[model samples]
Target: MVKRRDVRNRLLRLFVGVLLIAACSAQAAEMGGKSDARILIDISGSMKQNDPQNLRRPALRMLVGLLPEDARAGVWTFGQYVNMLIPLGQVDAAWKNKARAEAGNIASPGQFTNIEDVIKRSIADWEGSATLYQRHLILLTDGMVDISKNTKKNAASRQYILEQLLPKLQSHDAQVHTIALSERADHELMRTLSRETGGWYEQVNDAEHLQRVFLRIFEKVGRPDTVPLKDNKFLVDSSIQEVTLLVFRKESAEPTQVITPSGTQFDAKSAPQNVSWHRDIGYDLLTISHPETGEWRIQAAMDPDNRVIVVTDLKMRSSQLPSRFVLGEVLPVTVSFTNQGKQITRKDFLDVVNLKSCHTDSNGTGEARPIFDDGQDGDKAAGDGEFTLQVGQGLAAGKVELVILAQGKTFQREQRQLFELADPIPMQVTSTDEGETKVRVQPDAELVDLESLEIKAALVSQAGEEQPVMLLPSAEAGVLETSIATQELLGDWTLSISATGQTRSGTELDLTLDPVRVRGTATPPADPPEEVVEKTPEVQEPAVEPATMQAPLADEPATEEDNSTFQVALFGGINLLLIILVVLAIWIMRRRKQEPEFQLVEEDDQLVEEATAK
Candidate 1:
């Protein structure tokens, strides 16, 4: 019975061990499955001359094809502006083919290298769509951010990258791996960006090596090692500020040793001030703060295999900056720092913060000096990490970048934010004759070659009724005329005008004209009533007619037949004269009234003339 019990106990222990191994394997596999990547290729004019072999095209194709079939990936090209050729989606064969074709068609006609813009756009694409576990951005640029003659403009570009782009990348659990294509590339900035986001930065001497580098990156992201590590040695370059080594093994009791490039050795028990170690079931973490620039070595002993991952220690946290700005408005930017997922509250890390603003345009660049917080200008507190700048005065209307630089005794970092500066819509309203309102909308003076403009007007009554007023365009340029009969809208009326249009083909603007009261001349007086006159009878005229008639009758009358004929003639003559007199009276009365003889005039002649001219 004792022998049987011992055998059963051994079997139980073996089953528990197997279960633990399976759990570790599952966790590692889950980590590998959570990555979404965005590949950004710089297609600025310099690319045409710098990359003669055109290796970037093939590099992109290979990257898309190599990414895990289930992984979500996107492709983008950047120059003066950033364009997403493909949004984040499954890496199916059909999608891969389409992406490759688009990649090949990318041209290098863009004049400037707008790196900040591209980074901003990529983050926006990933925030809502990418996998929740791991997000990655592989940025390849051959030149520095397009710097304008204005110092502020250059500073703004750098600020945007550090403040806006870097924070977004971190919050999404995204890493940005940058590749410097040539010596002219801003290697320092790229390195800082990568280190801050827990990513790698590599510099290549030629374009031919792009494909190999990209493939290596894909392997690291898509196919992380599942096999446990027995012992491993790696190199940490001078560019890396800090190093973190994660050791995963089946047994936590095993011993581990870390050796710096200087050949100095330290273990878990005797770690130095720069080194810290933590132990957990099946895993151990060794962190070397402010590590030396040379190679580092690690050795571990365990019954089962172990895995080691070396990551940079630098991390950053920051606030989102405004991306759209009106012509004359102030922009507020705030940034903070973090170490290993915890906010850094140390005074040393928060001191020595420098902020600068820059504006970039085709003509040149300009710098806006920092505005100190005096409890005004939208700043709540000084030295509180919030920075403010008033934009649009000296700044050109275009892209603006805000840069923040901060330094600690152990580490120094920089961040950048980007914004689009636009002019406010200009409108003029005037009251014209006939209660009509004339509104003139002019395209922003800073804008050139506007596409179209739409204007609408409405009269809002005190009773909350809206009466839409028609806007008619006149022959004069930039003029829109609309009339509202004051008689029709007698009560208090508020005129509201809305205008929408594109300054350029894709730059849209929607604005409302300031409300104005509809005013008009005093109402015309009512027509006066006609006066009535009494008429006196005419007595003298009757007597004169009787004297003449009596004389004429005496000369006539003798024979009966003659008298009858004479009487008939006189009566007939008198009737004929009376008929003539009545006809004449009717003619005079009709002329005085000025009525058409027999026709009706449908419209007033003056109104018809005005309508025809219009």
Candidate 2:
């Protein structure tokens, strides 16, 4: 009986686990496999100057409103520390309401900008590779990675993000989209993070357009199905169950007049019963449920940013291009369409459609390119829904927007990707020994014309004075050298670099690099070498010594020498006296021996006489 009960409990547990897995899988399938976003906002002190009006509050609210209901999201504000302003959870009415309420609390009251720490903390829960959801990290900042006053530590923080933190993000398939809010922001690092992670990057000079920027990023993250709008008119297919119209206003009234397929007209205030309209500072978002499958039009002051997104069975899909690229890198771009959440791979349908691509340079001049499904142009197979194009060859180095247009005799779809082409020969500045500032340009020899790379630089003082410094060819090839004069290298200076070069393919390259901040106290000038004076040698005459106090002999320090000489003389005299005494003793001994007998005989006679007298 006990064994049967245990088996029964085990079976019931297994059943419950299977059902839970199925429910989770169903939730992922509903969101089209990936829709999780992590938003990181900078609350550093610098934002006070950059975003004084605190326009980010409204911008963030707009983003929170636009996020799909099924997606999971969280918000974090980072400065010297990171705070989870909103916990990560599935987006619902409650979550959106909470986010909206907290958006007002966004302020620039925090201390240093610790980008690395915030990013690490934001992704703490993410460990493994992307599977069920496509993760997005949207970072907004107005300053560089400044956790301390030490410049080296700040540089180390930036490097740690690129070298260590970036790989972990990549491993987890987290797209890091960075928005720079000021000119002083670290654009180089911002561009690199987004470029490396295949995410969007934008620089907003004014806070006024922040809402628009957020909307653009939302489109990328949401991957919303959008129908092409031509001259304020769009055709909604039968598969579109819902349509959301985003219209920009010029005068702060109703953004636009939305006319439905059934000739029903609506605006923000006079919207139909089923239509949901939201009016914000600069734009309006109208969500229509079960829209008619026919032509629709909007009457508004024409704006390029006007858009209509749909929730439908038919969706156009494309692999996103990276946010930035090096001059020599070539990447493959692909576009396709899916119906009912599956790729439309029908050759007959694909044959009737045309997919075209063009790239617009910074000057708004677009050059057209060919895209095809034929097995020739980087496409794996012929007649597949996928269309491929190999781009980035001979393109100028700057901001370029890629536009892909697909037209199927009946419907049209379009997508745009913004990317930056970095200089092939990235320049580096280093504070060398002896106050020498060096600009090193080492591009791949095979890719760049080294001799044609011309480098120009200037030393900019704190007072904003420019002193053009010549960049001569350094000892190493492809290196440009310049020295920081002690007088000009006043503490807290900038090195401005302007370079023009050529690719091996004969393409001209013009680049304006970010000014490099060099920190050092001006070195004090070496005191003028002390003047050496030549003087005649003084002739010295010996002074006459007093009789009582004779001056010591000064020749060759003879005090010691004289003492030693006297000692030798005294020793020699004593030895001579000893020798004389010895000789005299010997002679006397011989004489005594010879004369002893005669003296003894006389003394004996005397003694005998004396003895007789006694």
Candidate 1 residue lDDT tens string, 491-595: 678888776665442445565656778653446678899887877785663443421343245556566988678877876776677677778878999886766
TM-score of model number 1: 0.33
lDDT of 2 by residue, 125-193 (tens): 997987678899999999999999999999999999999999999999889888999999999999889
Write down the TM-score of every candidate. Answer: 0.33, 0.63
What would you estimate as the lDDT of candidate 1?
Answer: 0.64
Quality of model 2 by C-alpha lDDT: 0.81
Please report how far candidate 1 places residue 320 from its true position, in Å: 30
